[model samples]
Target chain A: MVSILGVGLGVAALLVVQTVMNGFGEEHRLRIRESFGDCVVIAKSPIEGPDVLIARLKADPEVISASAYTEGPALARRGAFSGVAFVRGTDPLATDQPVRQYVVAGSFDGLDDGRVILGIGLARTLRVAVGDKIEVWSPVMAEQAEKGKAPLPASLEVCAIVRTGFTEVDDRAAIIPLRRFRELWSLGERAHGVTLRLKDPANAVATAARLNVGKAGLNFIPWQEIKKNFLEAIRFEKTMLFFLMFIITLVASFSIGSTLFSAVIRRTREVGVLVALGAQRWHLVGLFGVQGLLIGALGTALGFLLTWGILYFREGILDLINSLFGNGDMVANVYQFSKVPLHYDAMDFVVAAAFTLIVTTVAGLVPALWAAGRKPSEAMRDA
Target chain B: MPKVVLQATGLKKSFASPNGPLAVLRAVDLVVHAGESISIRGSSGSGKTTLLQLLGGLETPEGGEVFINQVEQGLVTPRKLLGHGVGFVFQNYQLMPELTALENVVLAAKIIGRSQVEGKARELLQLVGLGDRLRHLPSQLSGGECQRVAIARALINEPAVILADEPTGNLDETTGKEVMKLLLEVVAQRQTALVLVTHSREFAEKASRRLVLAGGVLSSA
Candidate 1:
């Protein structure tokens, strides 16, 4: 029973750590995909006939949707508040835009030639809400004003507020309609690039490579390339944690081995009697091997249950921990997640269970071999 | 012309001691026919148990060979010999402590690849006067009852011979006498050869043949 509990605790600790790591990775990926589409096609200068390029991109089987967009740095000012933001102009009529899902305050449909959408953090900085007006000045307009050819700032009403849960996007992003952006930047019927959503986001890098081949004056950038270091770091950390946590199960297997060794010593006479009664060496080995297997199976089952219970009460447990440690919002402040996330991947459970069972069964075989190797007469005499 | 169920010739075994190699059995020879009972008596540190082990193929003799039911011990695997050819009864009543009396008896049959022997095991237990204690574990049974369970276990597979090594050594005098009577009665009824190793002269006298092992040799008592 002690050995079983040891295996159970080890399995539970490994699964919990692995699932939590998976959850964090999934959460970050979801946020990145929400703020930026799977890939973006950028040109050296403004892309002429962008609608043609968008239509061609949408024709591909892997492409889910494509929207031509214009983006640049701008200064946003409302009343006494002012902050620098990246202004993005997108087709107001496009329904399948990735950022449309993150509209928290108002509807994305409200965006038009005279309206704009503000990121939650940008709105907070400018002290504005839906129906409030803010003046936006492009870098070119600022340069014109410095040359005394002063162009009036474009004043637009805030129609929506989006919180992508990514500080990079949420803190400095403003969206306006494509026509209004063209008028502000004095570009006619041209866009900076086309952002594309794909059916399988995981294939974004490959799709980008295929799209870039023989396409002149355009560079396709996948979302993974945009955040390669961060994603790779998460994956590497998970792998290291898996091996580190596996040590617990390895130690538990040693406990099982020790227990069986003691059992062999204690039952030396019984082993002799069994051998004398016609039991083969393999039979004795199987007896102890089955014992180990039973322990591993029961422990793995208990560990799965423990993982479920922990995931189910994750919020309450986190609250208790925070209450004890006096860092109630540490996850939110450090990881940018409101609560601890948990993602269940079937493969993780299978790997952990198989590894533990193999280790424990091998551990059992060591002592079993010792018992089977004993001479029956010597065994009885020793006992 | 009774069939020879067990035979051993020129069997030799030795153990290593601090002083030198201690010869336990130099040249042990024995033959037992069906339904014949032989008791081997010896002093402490004598080779009585070693001789019994050699005959049963539990110990490999450095010289000579053992034959059980016409099969040579060194030629065939010990598993085949021990499983179907011989049964063992140890001094300590070596019943598995975790198993019930009935399971302990059935385990012998299982070891011989004979399933569906619960009825046979139950009958054997009843014959040994342990019908009411079949569900009891070894720890729960008394010394006499445990020895009875061991006897039933020995008879479960109905082997050619039963090798009993001081089976009643741990029991009281009254219980030992009863266990010996039961063992002898059961062996005779089944026509199974019996090779009993003991230090009791009274028990040795009751056997069809009696021998004493001394100085690594066996002589007629």
Candidate 2:
């Protein structure tokens, strides 16, 4: 039972931690994909026919939807509050569901008609309530205003506040209709880049590789390229955690090795009797070996079962824990998630089982060989 | 010459002590014919157990060799030693603690590929007056009962020679006498050769041939 607990706890901890890490990784990946699309195609210089390019991009079976967006730096002002924001001009009239799903408040329904959306953090800093007007001064047009020219001063009512939970996007971002942007900046049919959504977000890298963006004077960037550092950190941390947590499993197996060794010492006289009765060295080896195997097998089975049970009831277990603590603050405050997320990958379970069984079996073999090598005369003399 | 069952020739044995090499037995030779009883008497630390071990092939002699039925015990392993008919009964009655009296008795029988000889094991245990204690583990049995179980185990293989090294050394005098009597009767009935090493004169007197091992040499008592 002690051995079972040792192995069981190790497996359970590993499964739970991996599930939590995977959940967090998935959450971040999905948010990034939903906000930025699976992949984006950028131009080295402004392309003349963006509408035709978008149509061509969407023609591919892998491409779900394509939208051409224009982005530029603008100094935003609302009454007495002022902040720097990157004003992104998107075709709000196009019913782009990928970007619209990230809206935390209000709607894009009236945005293309007469309003603009501010990121939640920018709205907080600008101190503009929903439906209030904010003025934006374009940096390119500011030089003309400084030379005694009438500047293109743009003003629009707030339509929505998008809280992506991504600080980089949320802290300095805004969205306005493309028609309004073209009118204010005196720009004609010019787009910064095109965002392309794919049927499978994970295929972004592969699709980007196949795309010949060099011919079009464009550079294809996958979603992974945009968020490489964060994802890689998570991957490296997960690998390190697997090795670090496996120490518990290692310590647990050491107990099994020592216990079997103690049993060998205690049974020395009996072994002598067996050998004296014509039992071969191989017989003794097989004896201790089988004994260790049985113990290790029992421990491994119990550990696997315990971990499986814990993982199966993990959500309910979290609920029970939350109820005990009288709050759902754990998911909201700690992880910024609505609920405790768990990803149960079958491969993870297989890896854990293989490691547990292999280590334990090897642990049992060491002492078994030691006992097998000893002469029966030692036991007899001790007796 | 009624066929010798066990023979030891010029046997030499030594141990590495802290001071120097301590010789236990030096150039000793002996022979025991089938169904013959021989006794070796030695004082404390006089190498009686050492000689018994060398003869049983439990340990290799520093010099010379042992033979059972004229088969030289070369590269003396347990399988070869026991296959040529040698059984051992230790001073501490080495019955496995986890096993019952019956299981202990049947150990030798099972090893020799006579697993079906459980009935014979039961009969032998019954002969040693342990019929009721067959299901008792060694921990549950008395010292004398444990010795009886060892005796039954020794005779299970029907080996030609039974090496009794202080078989009654750990038992009280009364219990010791009872165990020794059962041992002699059983071996005589089976017509098996017996070599006993003991410190008791009365026990040594029972053997057909008695010798005293003194100063690393076996001499007539």
Q: Best-fitting candidate, measured by TM-score?
A: 2
Candidate 2 DockQ category?
A: medium
Can you write out model 1's per-residue Cα lDDT over B1-221, one digit (the tens) per residue?
Answer: 88888778888999899999999999988888888999999999898887878887778889977887743432343345786878888888888889999999998888868999999999999999998988999999999999999999988877788999998899999999999999999999999889999989999888999989999998899
TM-score of chain B of each: 0.95, 0.93
Alpha carbon lDDT at A69, candidate 1: 91
Q: What TM-score would you give candidate 1 relative to the actual structure?
A: 0.87
For model 1, the TM-score of its B chain against the native B chain is 0.95
What lDDT is obtained when candidate 2 is compared to the true structure? 0.81
Model 1 spans > 4 angstroms off: A58-64, A75-84, A97-137, A145-162, A203-215, A335-339, B71-80
Worst 10 residues of 2 chain A by lDDT: A208-217
Question: Against the unseen true structure, what C-alpha lDDT does each candidate score?
Answer: 0.88, 0.81
Cα-based lDDT at residue A324, candidate 1: 97
Superposed by TM-score, candidate 1 places the C-alpha of residue B87 at a distance from the truth, in angstroms, of 2.1
Residue A262's C-alpha lDDT in candidate 1?
Answer: 93
Clashing pairs in 2: none
lDDT score at residue A36, model 1, on the 0-100 scale: 73
